[model samples]
Target: MPAADLPLLIEAVRMAGHVATGFVGKSAKRWDKPDGAGPVTEADLAVNDLLHKVLRQARPDYGWLSEETEDSSIRLGHDRVFIVDPIDGTRSFTEGADTWAHAIAVAEFGQVTSAVVYLPMRDLLYTAARGKGAYLNGVPIQTSAVTDFADATILAAKPTMAAKMWRSGVCPVFKPAYRPSLAYRLGLVAQAQFDGMLTLRPSWEWDIAAGALIVAEAGGAISNQRGASLRFNSADPRLDGVVAGGGLIHAALLDALA
Candidate 1:
């Protein structure tokens, strides 16, 4: 069933990307959330609306959870729920940047079964299904094989590298990088473009659900900042944080944080 759902997710995410691209440089209306959640543009809502209709119509029984849609407890009663972020990097999209992405995933009883993360402007599509391998633009991808922390290139925010967060009171020697889209950062790790990625602040489920599967399917390990397994479709959808990389690097990062 997960395999079957993969195609549907891929198609839905691609269409969402298409819808989003139409407004990329066209000055789509922008506004901010009341509690400083972040800026949102009309493009984000348009894509969210399109994905909701297309995905829900195809699987009416499946529940839905999306950044643009209001939260509901009804999804908790379903075995499979759709988790989505119409535009992962709204700030980038509003600024006419190509790094924004559409992230969609199917979580069955708290575990991701199928997922797709698409960046239309960049023309990169990442996809995965439970047990099957991850792919980028239809070609298989794998995490970086580098095993030493000193040699790793990690995608993360500046705060993630703060010395206070590490047990040694010093950051690792890996090259630090930044990406506006959390989903895209995870995909980079899956594609071996970056050895790993993390954010110590709590992360929303919609932002990382799809990328989590992609990294795992690509022969990488992904978990919360505490090195605990990630489970989706929960009553509270926010994750403690995310840390993903090749097995050794992933373990190393967690140990450093500890």
Candidate 2:
């Protein structure tokens, strides 16, 4: 693990985010991926191209995996790889919403060794390193200790798919705040703004790689709905679904979701 590469990784992601922010509301161009539901704007491709170029030039050894590019099985061979989401919330990006952002992280084997998330619209940068702790704009951060579900600032996507799953036979009164970007949503958890978050469907590794590390280093924890720690570099790219808050309420969220 070239753990020493944290600074370079952070700088690359910040620069990549700045480049992506340039295209907001400009109506440059856009398209969909293989699936018609997944939006891919010109900014996504542009930022993707920039990240590929910069990250490759900075750390030639790190394998690359991103949303705008094709899948690669070569990452299985590298102990460390750069997992990136050029623009995590393309829907919000094209809509000129402030919820969108960029995510980048270094995964050693399956663990995230470092992470950096830049919210382009908000000009916010969140970062973390394994065992080193998390920071939001360089200020140290940690998760909320709110154990009471009624008081906990719950968060999740709109329509509340996971909320329905949790309320179907349990915790019917709990209401989690709906959020857009998975990075920013999870960043809220790492920053202690929210206590728990639930994701109903599977997500790409890039979307949560940096967020997961932010949670971890902030003295919080994360896992798929089944309560498993997240890992990157799978051929399918759909890593897993649903991660609860860290700290005391995590177990409760897991039990309710389970």
Candidate 3:
């Protein structure tokens, strides 16, 4: 069942990515969400519409949760839901950066079963299916084996450099790289291009669902910053930050945050 959904998920994300790529470097109408959330664009809606049409038509039984769509209580009844971020890095996309991506995932009984994150501008495709491992353009991937938290390279914002975010009052003690898309950053960890990734702010499920599974499939571990387990398709699809990395690195980071 997972294998069957994998191709469909990949195709839908690729299609969304293709649609989003058309808005890159071009003038796109944009606006801010109510209450100072973040920017939104016509591109986001366009991609969301396409994904909603293609993916849902392919599997009508799956519920939907998207960054650009209205949330509904009906989704709670489904055992499987499609968590999507039509264009994850809208800032990157609108600013003509190729780091943005379309993130898609199918969560079954609160766990991701199939996932895909495709950067249309960059032509990078990341995919994962439960028990099948993770892949980048068909090649299997894995996270770095770094055990010492200080030795691990992480993806995070400049503010996280401060030591206050950790329970120990000391940061991970490693320099972190910045990526515009959260999904892409997690994909990098899964590919071992980075040892780990984290965020100190709450995150939307669509932004991390696919990436979380990708990391898990690649022999990495992902959870809330406090190292709690993550479950999807809930009444509220928001997470209190995230911490993901190769096994030992994950453990060490979790301890620091704890």
Candidate 4:
């Protein structure tokens, strides 16, 4: 709500972004999540520590939730919470790729109000403020106007990690997308660089919070695969699905994936 805090949030993310990039291609140690789909690295912990300290200093009243930290009931007491993913694409980063970066968001009363996704490798920052509009770097951004589904360029969340869904009637083939970071992937749609993205793999609040606002403000739509609204800070943090598309091809994209 405070206009001055926007720049501070951006700065914190940018600084964190720099630290994350420092570990790239360094053979950082990685471990798998409980589900074992991908890995988490030490780089994630380093950035998570930096983010918590910086954000708390900037806004002590805000609560915290991040992929690297243990979930606590403390966040429910605060009016605002900072949701973060220290490294959204650890697999990519560990593989000597440039798709990883720090993702952060600020949600008030469970409603995402502002966000920042810093793509350190590309030096592209995607940000948003509810009602104010979305931006890439300092310039404003919007989703694509492509009204036709056939011509739209799509990004798949599990693009290369699709072997897990072969039995669900939905083929589990991860499509190769240029933006490896989930936050940045949604940003592409908001910037009109891509038409949409589909992912059967569940995503967390921090993964898409800023990107949701980015696409929404950029004249697009974001929702569960069944075309439902999103609610943050739930007991179960996993979102069953997500379809982020420019306003036009949204419905059709869902149908095609079905």
Candidate 5:
């Protein structure tokens, strides 16, 4: 029954966003993460450092887990943890695409208690606290009311469409949206801009934790591909995937993907 630390979470993300915005378009050091995986820029490190210091100082008892930081088994010992992605959609950020966001969430007992996803470039703030509902720029928001699967508008990847990931090899009625930031995609669903959003591949916790809570509080449902509730601050810190939308649309999408 504990409530989310909404105010602190919001402040931390906005502070991180400031550091991110300062380096969005300007020149900064960039490199691969040893495995030739994804790109990491100076902005990511700067924001991560600031959040790590600020949030941990504010809540010394909370554990820390972030995309930019190396995984630490020590976090597993705590009942509460701060899960963060300094900048989701780093690809878009590095390219100055204005689609990146700072994603942060507080997880206690395997569920997010509070969350925030801030897109500094767009000057948008999406936030949610457990049992308090969700909001976008201080206005309450909800998911679309579309219940029919055929009419549901989904945000998805081009590859998913080409591979026919949907049930019966049929895509949604409208063109699938392509947003680089997974957090932004979920935020959009919370705002009812899209009926739902999905991904079949494994997703990092930092990528979807904040967004999941936001969607859930906005009267939407969130779960992995199997429709299982997502648990965070895990030792693995990764999820099978995500499927979220308005109540009925969510159920229908799960049925389709199933």
Candidate 6:
């Protein structure tokens, strides 16, 4: 099932990437979303519309959930759903940075089965299917084997390192890194480019759904902030946070955060 969906997601995400690249540095009209939900651009909506039309047309029975689309309880009734973030880093895209990505996934019974994250400017395509492993540009990928917390290089916003968040009351020492797109951070972890990634604030499902499956298929561990398994297509469409990395580092990070 995942194998069938994998190619579909890859094609959809690649097409979405093409649409997004057209707006890069071209001054696509942008504005802040109401309630400070971050920025949105004409490119975002265009890409969203294209993806919605293409994917839904191909899988009429599948439910739909996208960052650009209004929420609908209709998805909860379907056994399979498509979760998408047409542009995972609006700020990066608007600022003419190349780190933004198109994240897409198919979820069945709340578990993601197939996923893809495409960064057009970077020419990076990350894909994965549950039980089939992860890949980067068609080559297999895996999480870093680093187990020592202090030696790990982690991707996260500076706020995640705040002393109060960890049980130690002082941030555990690890090299810190940052990426504007949540999906790309997870992809980097899947590629073993970083030891792990996390965020303390609530995360949107579209931003992390595809990456979650990629990381898992790459032999990494991922979960909500409290170390619970991550589920997709929730009615609220948000998660407490995300913690993902190689197995030993993932466990150690969870232990330290606890």
By the lDDT metric, which is better: model 1 or model 3?
Answer: 1
Model 5: weakest 10-residue lDDT segment is 159-168
The sequence of per-residue lDDT tens digits that candidate 3 reaches over residues 1-258 is 788999999878777777777774448999999998789999999989999999889999999999999999999999899999988888887788889888999999999999999987777899999999999999999999987756778898887667787788777678689998999999999999999888978899999999999999999999998778988988999998988989888887778773
TM-score of each: 0.98, 0.93, 0.97, 0.88, 0.95, 0.98
lDDT per prediction?
A: 0.93, 0.81, 0.89, 0.78, 0.88, 0.93
| Poorest 10 consecutive residues by lDDT, candidate 3 | 17-26
Q: Least lDDT summed over 10 consecutive residues: which range in candidate 4?
A: 166-175
- Model 5, span 161-208: residue lDDT tens: 653676777765654777999999999999999999889889999999
Shift in Å, residue 250, candidate 2:
1.3
Between which residue pairs do clashes occur in model 1? none
Residue 135, model 1: Cα distance from true site in angstroms: 0.4
**Candidate 2 structure quality by residue, lDDT tens digits, 5-101:** 6788778878887787677544758777664658888888888899899988878888988877877788778878889898888888888788888
Any runs in candidate 2 off by more than 4 Å, and if so which?
Answer: 1-3, 158-164
lDDT over C-alpha atoms for residue 55 of model 5: 90
Give the per-residue lDDT of model 4 (tens digit) for 62-118: 988888888988787888888889888787888887777678888777778888888
Off by over 4 Å in 1: none
Write the residue-wise lDDT of candidate 1 on 89-168 in tens digits.
99988888899999999999899999999999989999999999999999999999989988999998998888898999
Candidate 4 lDDT (Cα, 0 to 1): 0.78
- Give stretches of model 5 more than 4 Å off: 1-4
Report backbone clashes per prediction. Answer: 0, 0, 0, 5, 0, 0
